[model samples]
Target: MGERYEYVPHRLLRRRVRDIASGVEGELMAVISENVSGVGAEHWVELAYVRGPSGREFTTSVGNIESAPGGEAG
Candidate 1:
């Protein structure tokens, strides 16, 4: 069997993120890094580090990320 990959939406990457502590919204600069794994049958988790325009970074985890429409997984 071959390893399966997931696709992240480019739009989502560009969306602004709000800081929970101060309620400030910052622009998402880039997806700095990502880690993905299958936890069980039909279940997966992805952890991604996103950089802000101000050079701040934050970690976010998402589950069951699907491939983008008309796009290939990476």
Candidate 2:
């Protein structure tokens, strides 16, 4: 049998996220880039590109997002 997959809403990519480990709370930033379905149907995965306060770029999965405030779609 083939693996089942579901479509992720584009609105999810627009939401901002912050790293709880950074120790600074209540801060959010938009994802500059993403591959919504890089893993394909077999393994559903969503990746987002974000820039930290330090000006460092990193990738984080949608599931990892601590918070998602609905905003403009990227």
Per lDDT, the best of the predicted structures is 2
Give per-residue CA lDDT, model 2, range 13-73, as digits (tens).
Answer: 4345554444322223343332234454433455445565566656565445565343223
* lDDT tens readout by residue for model 1, 1-74: 23454455544455555434444444443443233335645534454444545677665543212223332321
Candidate 2 stretches with Cα past 4 Å from truth are: 1-16, 20-44, 68-74
Model 1 Cα shift for residue 65 (angstroms): 14
Structural similarity to truth (TM-score) of each candidate: 0.35, 0.38
User: Once superposed on the true structure, which residue ranges of model 1 sit more than 4 Å away at CA?
Assistant: 19-24, 29-42, 53-56, 62-74
RMSD of 2: 7.5
What's model 2's lDDT at 9? 50
